[model samples]
Target: MRKSELDTPCILVDRVKLLDNIRRYQGYADAAGIALRPHAKTHKTPEIARLQVEAGAVGVTVAKLGEAEAMADGGIRDIVVAYPIVGSAKLARLIALARRAKITVACDGIDAAASLSEAALQSGLVIDVWVEVDPGYGRAGVLPGADLDRLASALVPLQGIRVCGALVFAGHSYGAETDAEREAIARNEAGTALLAAEALRGFGFPIESVSAGSTPVGRFASAMAGVTEIRPGTYVFGDVMMVKAAALAIEQCALTVLVTVVSRPAADRAVIDAGTKVFTMDGEDSAIGTGRGYVVGHPAIEVAWFNEEHGILKLPDGERGLRVGDRLEIVPAHCCAVVNMLDELHVLDGDRVGATWRIAARGKVK
Candidate 1:
């Protein structure tokens, strides 16, 4: 089967480009003397996760216990849940998972660590955990310098939880304008994380892994001497934001939504089958760019507006040649959410359908 034969509003991944991305990042991590643990939240497919492991990723990072279970069921032995697991239900599941694989979790506070430790002790298992250090994201982690020390100290001698090291998400470096700025941001974050790790060690805690990195920051994070692993997710499927950020070229984008022109309202306007439901309404807040997704192969065609099922395109004055039934590939503004919207992804290699991978853990938020 070919991509042209697939139904509209479907997710399509370019096999060759995806492999290139995986290999490129893996090579960078290998050369930098760091472990590559690509996040599974982006692709959420065991096949792709296995590809990363085969390409030299030490393991895969999952955001939830359900994702970890899916990967484990798919034969992935090493897993890391980068989010904090709090509730008893989820903690029990996490401990059970630890019995099967080398599973790890992240903690940024005392209560969460105590819960995890209690769960592990009840299950007769020891769970390795990373102390999350805030790297200016202000999302989940504890403040790096002193706050991190406090949390690490609180976890000491916990029955079944071992403080392995630190974890920082360099999300602030994503939209940086230049490579120098991005590198500087990653270096600063990595330095702070390393300092916190040393502080934990000084307090008699064993710090084994100092992890940091995102797709945009991976380029610079790989060069940071203290970072032991890079956890990049979007590199497996470059999106419009990555392209605009100059982190990836247009050809390197592995994921796109296949949409058909369903309405030609005017000479200079057309509507595509995909909209907020398929491409997602994210990454469009910048003052410097147009709205939502960008039409692939049509540089001048801008997705001016979108509803739940229809995307309005504003074609250039002389470029209004699109007709109903004509298909156009759209690179989503954010690929992660788009992947979650679908149940499966069509893998393609230069227009020829290669394979179909089930998105086994699309909406497993628990």
Candidate 2:
């Protein structure tokens, strides 16, 4: 089908740009001698996950069991659930998944490790697990040192859980304006993780993998001495936030939402068919300037605000040329969230629709 025939609010991925991004990241990982495991939560499509693996990703990292299941069903063998799987129902599903694929999970607490171990024992499978260390985010990870050591020790007694390595996410350093600053923060975080791993080693545990990454931090993290794996998801489709934050160039952005101007409300105001539902409302917390999104083709037009179904566009006083029914593409402020909001994505090459891929793992929170 032609690009124009696709439904409104549909996610569009530029196939060429997406492939370029994949290769660029893979090249970095290869040169750095670290395994590239692009997070599948960004695209949530098994086809894209396969593409990543084909592009030299050692495996795919998913944020949830449902994503892992989808990738497994699509023939992906090496899968890592980057989040802790708790509760009986989710653990049961995780155990079932372990039987089909080489699975790994993240744990930050004794209870979670014990639960996972029990589940793995029940399934009669040994699952590789990583200890999530909190560098600074203060979210879902054990603090370095005593806390982490406690969790690692607790996992030793678990029958089916194997401590694979340490995982640290350096997301808090993405807003740095200078390259030196970003690198410094990344080095500090990596150093801290390496130290923690050394402590674990001193305690007689083998540390196989030292993974740390965030799209912005990954640019400098490749230089860290001990990191063995780097997981950065958004680098696959650079979004407006990443571009403005200096993580990627405009040309690197592979995703855009096609919207038609529905109204020219005033000389400086216009309205587009895309809104909060289409363009994610995640720009407020971004390091870049606050805005709904950026008009892909019109550099001067700013997406000032968005309602549930309409986007308010503000054109420069004398730059109001867009008329009603005019189609314009927009790069979302955050591509990952935008992907989650849609059920399918249209793969396009230039203006032609190349393929259609379902967002199979959308809303897989459990």
Cα lDDT, all candidates: 0.85, 0.82
Off by over 4 Å in 1: 285-290
The digit string of per-residue lDDT tens for model 2 on 175-239 reads 67788877887888788779877876766667898888777777765677798888889999888
Sequence-dependent TM-score of model 1:
0.96
lDDT per residue (tens digit) for residues 65-184 in model 1: 999999998889989899989898898788788888889898888998898888888888888988888888778899976777677667776879888878988687876888888888
Clashes of 2: 0
Global lDDT for candidate 2? 0.82
Task: Give TM per candidate.
Answer: 0.96, 0.95
- Distance from true position, residue 134, model 2, in Å? 0.8
As a whole number from 0 to 100, the lDDT of residue 201 in candidate 2 is 76
